[model samples]
Target chain A: MRLINHIPGRPAALLLAALPFIMIFVAYSIASDIRLTANPQDKLLPAPTTIVETAERLFTVPDKRSKEILLWNDTFASLARLLGGVTISAMLSLALGLAIGLLPYARSLFSGFIAVLSMVPPLALLPILFIVFGLGEVSKVVLIVIGITPFMTRDLAQRVMEIPKEQIVKAQTLGASSWVIALRVALPQILPRLISNVRLSLGSAWLFLIAAEAVASNVGLGYRIFLVRRYLAMDVILTYVIWITVLAFVIDWLLKSLSRRAFPWMEANL
Target chain B: MSFVSVTNVWQRYGNRSILERVNVAVDEAEFISIVGASGCGKSTFLRMLLAEERPHKGDISIEGGETAVEPNRERGVVFQKYSVFPHLTVRENLIAAESFDKPFGRLRGTARKQAEQRADTMLERIGLNHVAQQYPASLSGGMQQRLAIGQAMTAKPRILLLDEPFGALDPGTRLQMHDFLLELRDETNMTVFMVTHDLDEAFKLGDRVLVFDKPRWDPQDPGLFGATITYDFDARNKGMPFQDILDQYPSLSLG
Candidate 1:
């Protein structure tokens, strides 16, 4: 007897997708229960109820010292730094990348240098950035920018290079100047690719952001997590980690939806 | 003096020559077809006229003006592939074609309305009104070619340069496109210069045909020289009536 392997339908697929998470939850819950039973105070893995209570308190209650909701403050600070760094990096890369991709002189002058610069690890320069920029928000935001700008610029430049030569020639024949071709013919095509590139680079951006904040910051997600770690605050750390993962996932989904709605002609892979 | 003139034009890439000392003149509203082997200089000559590339020697001028330097709205071109912008819908493509010369600030209000009207008329004439919102990728090969041609015609250029516009079409569709092109030409009275490999296509659509080849080819030294217009036949009278001229120039090879 032969058994055929067929693709699962929607409901089966959803159940299959949820299976791994359920297993992980059950395993963690059982471990937590055993540890708590062995000793009523287990800091390594707290019970699920402790985590829920911590979440409710952290979300609703305000800090007695600062008079501000800690979670919201942390979220707002981190998001502002991230948005500021990424927006500036994106705009700069678009202009620089187009010049590098379209103009021979610009490509020859900076392409090799940019390639070499991309090789140097961004984390290695964190100490220097902290030294020069000091322990302010500037260093944190600058770290995020420095971490992802070269990669994003290179990606956008490569995307621009991949545009068909015929389109450039056609645009020229259509009375578009070099600048016009750069803006109208090439920029529109690469915008969706840029968004996809930004989506891919978000992980690295977050890594740098957290590292910078953890090293030195009064407020932010990473600062709060690192601060509470001295007291073995596992529940707070777990809640924050899960919250960060959800936030990242939602941002990715929003960018993808934006790309689809704005530039419907882009291939579906983007 | 003709409307378009190619005088002592020669093209070289480093040491290798592509076209050497070529010369031709074409009047207004003339449909000239160029035929040759794949590596021949017919397409290169067309490129020179379009000002995509400048000849190493001599010049190509239109309407007694300065030597052509770069491609502009005065010369419209349709390539064998990617003839239409994939990002744009058919109607937008046509509208953009007419609005190309206008300043960015002036592309709104009355100018935009007029451009849309022109695009609608062109779409109706080309029988693409139903798929006006469709992108070039979704259209069939023949339909894309029609849209490409229609897109080029919308610019109202003085000369339309086609680089094998029908080379990618099937036999039936190619024939239909030929009729469509002839009708379009008659209606608009636009000058056309086409490069193709099919001799029958050249004969069918052209008022004159130019053949590019090397007249003197040495087996060992084939790289020393380049191809030139070895034969220019007047195809004004249809049905292969240039037999007498072919007989007179016995060295001419039809293929």
Candidate 2:
């Protein structure tokens, strides 16, 4: 009866979850109908059928000049750069985070530097990066790395610091050296956090990736979306945007499941 | 000769003195139980012995060796919680104890098989064989503490330190842990120092129960002085009465 006491059942919960998405669809359909009625050639909001058809064509049809499916090519190029940047960031952050979290000397040296680096808006460095690394794949990948590394590193460092003092002392008494402690003790525990951090940063990585592509990339989902905007190809742009959202969601879900499978002990704690 | 010795040990944290002029001596295979009210420096003294933190003054040495600057394989320790590695399964936690001494913190070939056998033996001894593959999070409080003690013993250290190792357990589990600790002590002549706030637990398992209290305290600044060993009862002797100890130190809580 009371709102606080009445927890929704499974079906109710499902419907509640779907309600917002359904409402968004209804709103978009009505708005599109009204605009199309006023002007048959309106490009602001495409009909649902138009978007689907555009997506199908994008997926199946090869470009006339390149003889490649533009959509698949763009997806592959973006994925390659994203994975490259993320892998490098994860490896570097793990090492730097462990050092900053465990060693006093490393903490003093990097903690302040990382704090300042994280404070500097990563997007603002876009121009400098483009100039230094040039308008090639390197610049785009570097933008993603520069965008997400500091936050991920700081998050991992905090998680490492949260490890109980007793565990560290227990490891020492077990005759584990500093290196052993990092590899055996700290590394196993922080891995779940690293995966979660990677998941958290994927959004920002995509943001940086898209910005780079829109600005300078010849082949990417962002480049395609930005290139068709001149003719107000709303159907193509909408398809690409939906595809990007799905990709980001899949990545986050995959990382979550991987962490759960890898670190069963972290089930309740995480 | 004493197997473990502490002479004129003092500890401080900035302006607050936690321990001062603490002295004790224990023979090999003796179990030393420490008891006092909270903030009386019992845990600090145990930390000093574990070499987790050094005393501000004086020294503590074991087997006539030089004072340990940091924790080493020569000594083992168990805390009330966070003693067992949560990430490792019950069996791996025990094997990890011995394997940590290896160069790579691991074992292979025959050494690996032997470590696994020893770990299995420890698991049986600790009565945790049923959950050998389970992580520490899934284990009960008593079982976790048993696993912790078992892990500590896997190294066969000369001395074992327990800092309120059973303080977090329920009353029933705590009693079981007492029996478990005594059985392990019977198997080996490992000098043990355990700090607990429970006076009854102190007398039940300890060979000599050492009570920490402040002999000198200023009325204006109560912490002007620090705590030291006020009573060391010979618990191994059945003739020693605890009723009299209770009357003497009413401040200590009896668990």
Candidate 3:
């Protein structure tokens, strides 16, 4: 049979999906074992079991200096910053995006400025942010906001512009003023798009959060990952990396479910 | 003075002209069916009437009011697609039509109750009471068209502008919508201006059919000239079969 004609059944599909994961696990174990045999003191690719054990210790045990569990503290701190930055970005982008997309004056003024702003590499402003906002939670959170807000604003503005002219005209004929159209017509329609935009921006939000944490902060997933590099603690790093991936996956899943529940009408389009 | 008047109107987009020297006048309850070849500015004229866009020159006024600057509650409109708001339910769409009249675009407490009741009546009239709670996406093409018309009707505007409103429906569904539209039109003195490609439909539902075509065609440069109303046929006395008119214009197909 030709390759194109072959369609996998449920069991075959499940097996195919698991194959790469299984191969990676087996390869890592063999490589780690060989490295250990060559030099038992090697810390770089410690066995998978060592990583699992470290994860358990990090998750459940309290730190020696501080009573707080390191993993949970890092996760909580990172989450709080991510939430703060992303929330502020969403609100600001929605307002700015709607104005840019809907109003001529706002579009003429901000559209060009926003275009220039989006082109500037956000990481270049990290030092400036630190100097202005200081190296506290504010700087880190601001980095995330600065990193993702422009893109979200642009995406949302495009989505708003994509709304059929017919609908806008219809709304106007229904006696809606500009504010009413923005609130009643344009707002609800672009909300699902904003949710979709947020989902896509989560990865970048995480990246900015980690970068800010790594550069200056004491407690965060990124800080822990960067901090342990001096000790060659592969096991701790791997544990933190896996946990971060899990958190990102959970966040993406929650946003998907939220979009599904709230804007069921957008299913076909989304 | 006519109830709705368009005098010496000219529309152009930059160097390219779309409409020019368009003049028409209608009574309050006239059903003006506008038929034209594709890109003949029928829709543009309709948009001008709805005050969605303005002509480059001249004037359009309704109820002897000042020249319209923007779309208001005075003129309602429906398009073939995106006529109804997708986010709102069938009943809520009708309620929205009326509630949008308020400065804040809201109906509160007792007003909300009354609006909902009126919406229910509109739903019943549109034969969409079964799906009143459903969003526009769940509705069929014909049902959605009916809901769109019903939504436009709820505002009770003296003028209704339709841009190929039933152009997307199937043949059977199109006929059903026709009946529904005519029945609704009989109940009110609403003046309607509908743009359609189908000559038969233009004559079927319209008191007068206005044909938009370019009087002067420039072969080298199409944009050198614009289209205007070339023929105005009064189809009020003729009923059912529009064979006499179709027989006169062979280039115009049945649909």
Over the stretch B16-70, how does candidate 3's per-residue lDDT look in tens digits? 9999999999998999999999999999999899987889998998867877889
Q: Please give, for every candidate in the order listed, the TM-score of chain B alone compared with the true chain B.
A: 0.91, 0.92, 0.92
Candidate 1 stretches greater than 4 Å from native: A1-5, A267-269, B242-255
Model 2 Cα lDDT, one tens digit per residue, B100-216: 878878999999999999899888999999999999999899999999999999988889999999989999999999998998889887899999988888888998999999999
What residue pairs are clashing in model 2? none
Q: Model 2 residue B220 lDDT?
A: 91
- Candidate 1 lDDT over residue span A44-95, tens digit each: 9999999999999999999999888999999999989988888878887898
Provide the lowest-lDDT 10-residue window in model 1 chain A.
Answer: A1-10
Model 2 chain B worst lDDT run, 10 consecutive residues? B237-246
DockQ of each: 0.52, 0.69, 0.68
Per-prediction TM-score to the true structure, in the order listed? 0.93, 0.96, 0.94
- Rate residue B187 of model 1 by lDDT: 96
Compute the lDDT of residue A162 as modeled in candidate 1.
87
**For candidate 1, lDDT tens digit of each residue in B130-162?**
999988778988899888889888877889999
Q: Residue B41 deviation, candidate 2, in Å?
A: 0.7
